[model samples]
Target: MSIEVGSKLQGKVTGITNFGAFVELPGGSTGLVHISEVADNYVKDINEFLTVGDEVEVKVLNVESDGKIGLSIRKAKEAPPQEREQRRPQKRSPRNQGNNRREQLSFEDKMNRFLKDSEERLASLKRNTESKRGGRNTKRG
Candidate 1:
């Protein structure tokens, strides 16, 4: 009846909280399954997954010398199909992938485009900057 690290056990959930669920092990001690350990997905609420008196299979993650036990319900279950999806890399944006349309432009073409953009931005800045500071006071004293 000893609860060892890395062991799997069946337990009845005795209580539920925003942070986690408390389960009473067959060996007569209770442990917590933290919200993060309850599932592989983003669990915004632990109550959605477990309830008081619900039986769960949990893997013993650790047993501290001070007697605090760490458990994981997700670890005891087989690899879920969604696990593969999460493991696969997400689709990257085309901009990040180095397939930028600008890359197709020749060096001279790029320089020309840059010069044109710079001129336009500088012209806009010059027009707006003076207005933001206000025109000189032309009123006669």
Candidate 2:
């Protein structure tokens, strides 16, 4: 059977490497599922997820010009119900979770912090400008 992009196919894991797994499709065609495409979460090792002779469902991502087909295992699996629920925005309490005893900063406190930061920045800029101007004063007698 001819495999096209977005086509789902059942394939056997023929080889496993650090980067990806090689799957043999029905038509004797081999495709590569890159490590990044192996799972929804971070996959540190490909072997942890797949082994030789294991049957897996994969989605054909692309068929390169050189006849190499790219497959994705993560894309083939349907999203879990919990994942769908988590995608929705969650309601949060107005109170801060950590440091319950610590009160929120007052407006004056915020203004003071901003002014202190601005003063330090201005001082640094003045120092840089003075250094640049001083460096230009070197002259031959």
Candidate 3:
């Protein structure tokens, strides 16, 4: 059977290398499974995930004009239910979770804090400028 991009097929691991694995497709045609396409997790060694003669379900990612077929084992597998659940919206507590059990700050308090921080930053910048100018003026004197 001719493999096309996006097609899924079962293949045997004919060869394995540091970079990728070669899979024998249904029509006896071979494809390369790039290291990046091996799995969702980091694959330090291809042998850890696959072995020669091992059967694997792979998705055809590309078919080059030179007859090089690129396959992906990661895309063929379905994501775990836990992963799907984690992606869903979660409920959060209304109360603030912190060591200080004080009530949430009001709009005015927030604005005051922001202003204070801005003033401190401006003051720090002014001090730096003054120090640099002070050195220059002293050198000229």
lDDT of each: 0.88, 0.90, 0.89
Instruction: Write out the backbone clash pairs for model 1.
Output: none
Per-residue lDDT, model 3, residue 51, is 98
Q: What is the per-residue lDDT of model 1 for residues 1-141, given as tens digits with 9 covering 90 to 100?
A: 789998899999999989999989987988889999999999999989998999899999998888788899999895667997898779978766786666888999999999999999998987777666674533334
State which candidate has the highest lDDT: 2
Q: Which ten residues in a row have the lowest lDDT in candidate 2?
A: 94-103
| TM-score versus the correct structure, for each prediction | 0.56, 0.58, 0.58
Clashing residue pairs in candidate 2 (N, C-alpha, C atoms within 3 angstroms)? none
Q: Which candidate leads the pack in TM-score?
A: 2
lDDT: the better of candidates 1 and 3: 3
| Collision count for each candidate, in order | 0, 0, 0
Instruction: Name the runs in model 1 displaced over 4 angstroms.
Output: 80-141
Expressed as tens digits, the lDDT of each residue in 43-102 for candidate 2 is 999888999999999999999999999999999995767997888767645665454433
For candidate 3, lDDT tens digit of each residue in 22-107? 99999889999999999999999999999999999999999999999999999988566899799876854564355234347777
Q: State which candidate, 1 or 3, has the greater TM-score.
A: 3
**The 10-residue segment with the lowest total lDDT in model 1:** 132-141
Kindly state the number of residue pairs that clash in model 2: 0
